[model samples]
Target: MPSRWLLSILTLILASAIVVACNGDNENTETSGKETDGGKPDDFVTLKMIMPGDESARMREFVDNELNDRLKNDLNMKLELTYIPWGSYQQKLELSLSTGEDYDLFWHGTPFVSGYKSKGYIQPLDELLQKYGQNLIKNIPAENFKLDQIDGKQWAIPSQAFTSAGKFTSVMVRQDLLESVGMTEIRTIADLEAFYRKMHAIDPSYYGYLETDRGHEVLWRELSGENLTAFDERNLFAVNEDTGELVNYVESDLYKKVAHLREDWVKKGIIDKNLVGNPQSKIDQENAGKLLFRVGAVSRAMENLQTAQKADSGAKLREYFLAPDKPRYIVAPSNEAYMIPAAAKHAERAMMFMNWILKSKDNYNFIIFGVEGKYYRIENGKIKLLTNDQLMYEWMWRNKNYFTAPTNVPDDVVRDMLHNDDNAKISRLFGFHFNEEPVKKEMAQVLTVYKEKFDLINSGLVGYNSGFSSAMTALKKAGYDKVFAELKKQFNEFNAGRP
Candidate 1:
């Protein structure tokens, strides 16, 4: 009773102390979460992306606004895309990768994909993918994943659009030209050669077959029933089912025979002499009505001709699929992919953005062609027309995936072509990532020599006979034998793991 006032004061002090302790505990829990979970939603984080130029206004806005906004709110991150023109993209990409630049997410292709993967520039997405990429794993099937896996890890994501080789390789002939020549039933590559001879003999003014200088040599290998030893740095050859051993194209006699055939065609003046360095050699000749037929990818050839026809009513393009001519034409993965680099500060966020695009058509189009009204306009229920010249070259590089897959194209001709083609299997190659770190060094030297010499031969720089021998010698010297041996071993291991 004598200490009542003192007791009340002590009680008030203890109650305040208890309140402070509870508040401190709450703050500690939140601080712990922030440290482990990256950052708060409102925190500003910038992700750098190097991609093709933004020539389209609609496309530019979509990247800056729609995509950025969605990513910021959903993943607590933002994107900063650096525009590199397609002509200089490879140079810039190589420079960035070599110098260890602090950027993330590269649109990889034949040279870039293999080159970067070999260099160990990307992270294996196995662990992260298993945890956060559940939807992605479900959408992409096991068969597709098996193709993308290198060694034992996933390096890049395949294009979800048109994974299968849809009647992939075809002869783009001017049907009108064939009808004019009375050659109605050209089936084999030999038959086509006969047509070429007839066209060249009758009128020396036109080339019987107008071919690009880059890949004509390789194409000849296929046309002549010669197996090619095409492999990435992973020492992986296209799997040979007959002998269970890796097939090296240069080791076979058929390769030399194919070279001789190309030389014969060149001697006959059937192929242009000055075609090697000219990027537009075939297209220019075709436009000038100086070409009877040309070789190209089926879907691409048809689309290009359709675009040309829109300008010139007389331009005609039709495809003769290789399957009808050759029985064993298996479509394999083309060397291109999209991936998040290991250095990506926002890799998780970037992956989320990619998954969203896969799920949301609106988002995909925004990344692809830009805002619908600005770059293109929907004419009817099924057509999208490019409205301006500014939008044309905007899609030369990074936006190719839009046209490749799940997005709806309003072009009836393109849609019909896709539906009819056999190689449009986007879901098949989704999960495969090949790892070639062990044989990378050996593969690099061999690949460099092969690419350089092969380019010259296809361009008609050296006599096909001598060129073939020189190429073979260089390949053998560069360790082609060791590479194939390793490839067979790894392939067997990979197959054993598959169900």
Candidate 2:
């Protein structure tokens, strides 16, 4: 028989072996990526990001030829980028997510984050940001993450969105036309109508009257208070932030008022009916120099000016801010962001990449703007844009400190783009995010009705009385009542659960 000390030693050895074997199995199954005893990855990991838009020759060359070498050296990892054509992007991404495709990060928008989160398609970044996103935490404001969180956990990282806290409903007009009409500036919708009438009377070319079909869109919703936020992507239903009351926007008095206002504009010939559903017609009109005025992104005024100048040398475009009194809301859906996949193999590595990109102005410029002289150029402190394909889709990786406008872009337009959302107010629904899962079927039916009827009314193409009647009938049939109840229930639950 073995001595007492010797037997104890053998027993300890066997237990230690069993633990090691069990740990090895669990680590391989539950976790991913190879790591050493020191808790660092044993081998260099390759992280891939997929986004929309086709890759250009120059972008391809820079990624494979130049960018990877630095990435490999600095992070001990390789970054691969892939693009899908915009037409097929959403479909492909959905298929990939459903089928458990292997990817680390992706580009998306804030509104869809709820859909992704509720469906278990994404991962929370609280711990990852704590460990590897120190720079992001330091640079990005804490308030910016409120809307991106679900159940108080950060689910996505908002990239630089050149927007002010509040939405502005502004019009871009041909300054040359305004000058010809002896108008210096337009401050109100009344002044705008006068200007439009004068231009129509003189030119008699209605195509140049208002090109608001596609390239130009009037965000007249700002005329409503910022306290209202959309419960649906379609904005058919909006939640009153102050009261947390769900209001059916399509059925509201405000909706009726705006629909009538637009009907009046169409009747008075201030807005063209032909351009109602024909966006291409408006685009052609703008490019062909027939557009007198349009409502759209004031930030794109420089681009519009440049394109217009090519047709008429004296063409000047001016942007006018229409809403100055209403407080801007900050927790709206973001148009662009970088999100980690729920099944990411190396989420920490992805955060490391984001942190490194934001660590310095130089890194942000390199990653977002690309090789200065080759992809873009800075002349006398003003940056000039060139054909950069990577920067086009990788806009989600942008940081504003490194952002510079092209020489053609005006200072005011640049300010509007950069300082957008600076003074935005937090929504009463700031901490609460509504998940549409419970009413998904009804919401889908509601949207189909909205697209067919409410869209025309919202656009001011149809008169409110008849449009409202038809829409309400269709909405009820599509089960808008069900959407209404679910939204109310969710809002109450969300509020009651709050401290």
**Best model number under TM-score:** 2
Which pairs clash inside model 2? 163-420, 164-420, 164-421, 165-420, 165-421, 208-290, 208-292
Q: How many backbone clashes are present in model 2? A: 7
* Residue 122 local lDDT, model 1: 69
State residue 139's C-alpha deviation in candidate 1, in Å.
4.4
lDDT of each: 0.52, 0.65
Q: Write the per-residue lDDT of candidate 2 for residues 258-362, one digit (tens) a residue.
A: 677677778787767776766556666787766777764435465576567766768777776555555555444244567888777777777777877777777
Candidate 1 — which residues are off by over 4 angstroms?
1-41, 52-79, 83-88, 110-115, 127-139, 166-168, 173-186, 190-239, 268-270, 278-295, 302-316, 323-335, 377-381, 388-436, 492-499
Predicted structure 2, TM vs. truth: 0.75
Candidate 1 per-residue lDDT, tens place, 104-145, comes to: 676765334544767867665554444345445445433333
TM-score of each: 0.70, 0.75
